[model samples]
Target: MKVKVQSLDGGKPGKDIELSDEVFGVEPRADILHRVVTWQLEKRRGTARGARERSDVARTGKKFGRQKGGGTARHGDRRAPIFVGGGKAHGPRVRDFNPSLNKKVRMLGLRMALSSKARDGNLVVVDSLDVKEAKTKALKERLGTLGLGRTALVIDGDALSVGFALASSNLREINLMPAVGANVYDILNHDTLVLTRAAVEKLEARFNG
Candidate 1:
């Protein structure tokens, strides 16, 4: 698949570039994408903390009162849950939230995410993100000219350009990342996906490498 490349400012139009069918031409599968997204989010969850149980607490195990009724009632050990500063009767146990997933599923989901953007015409190929001035206003005007959607995720080559990164840092609607950091969650989160020429090469090479 070939996509036209343009400058970020939309002033210069570059040559068209070819995209990989396996990467950007795939037919999206919602189920596969859901599984991968769920897996990714699940891994970010923290384990539930557990409270100390009766056995775990450091309390006197000695008999508190006589076996026979002594005035009020007979009592066993101070470690009993009813006593003050005693261990809890039932406490939640620690549980790890990490879930295992197959590697292929993750890869397929990423491809589908990229393909979804391409198929929907939400993918924009750019010559580069290099800007003379790293001013946020200038960059914003430039992006506005491009007519990118509500939210845009720009993927650069192996390393992001410092100027573009700094310029877009304050803009909540615009996200910047390197090709290595591109994933299904971030890709699908944005309304538009912008790929630089270098990013395109790296992404294609990544799957085909």
Candidate 2:
């Protein structure tokens, strides 16, 4: 598929670039996308949450009442789960949330995400992403003039320009990443995708290999 490359400062059409159909023109698979997104999010989740068990509680373990017949039932100790100050019976424990999926599935999910953006007309191609000065305001103005959405993801080549990286760092709504960091979740999270010609070439090579 061929997409017109445009200027970063102003949305002027430049030369067209060829994109691989397998990479950016495939039909999006919702199941694969969901699995990949879930995996990504789960891997980043903190596993520090824990609940104290009976043995971990500081309450007394002495017998509260007779083990025989007593009004309402026999009591064990203050650390019992029936008591208010007792530890939890089966609460959540610290454990990793990382999910493992097939490598082929992950790659396919990324392709689906890119293809979905292209099919929805939410993908924008640029000649290159660079800034004269690393000023946040200047970059914002330039992107605004280009008619980008409030939340957009910009993917650069293997090496991103220092000025462009620093300029976009302060913008909360804009996400900048190199082709290596491109993934299904980040691509689908943004409202629009801005790709440079070099980034597209890199992505094509990556998927092809």
Assess each prediction's global lDDT (C-alpha) against the native. 0.89, 0.89
- Model 2 lDDT-worst window of ten: 4-13
The superposed Cα distance between candidate 1 and the true structure at residue 102, in angstroms, equals 0.5
Q: How does residue 172 of candidate 2 score in lDDT?
A: 95
The candidate scoring highest on lDDT is 1
Per-model TM-score versus the true fold: 0.91, 0.78
In model 2, pairs of residues that clash are none
Q: Residues 84-201, candidate 2: write the lDDT tens digits.
A: 9899999889897878999999999999999999999889999988667889998998888666776999999999988988988999999999999999999999999999998999
Q: Where does candidate 1 clash, by residue pair?
A: none
Q: For every candidate structure, what is the RMSD over all alpha carbons to the true structure, in angstroms?
A: 1.9, 3.9
Best by TM-score: 1
Weakest lDDT window of 10 consecutive positions for candidate 1 = 68-77
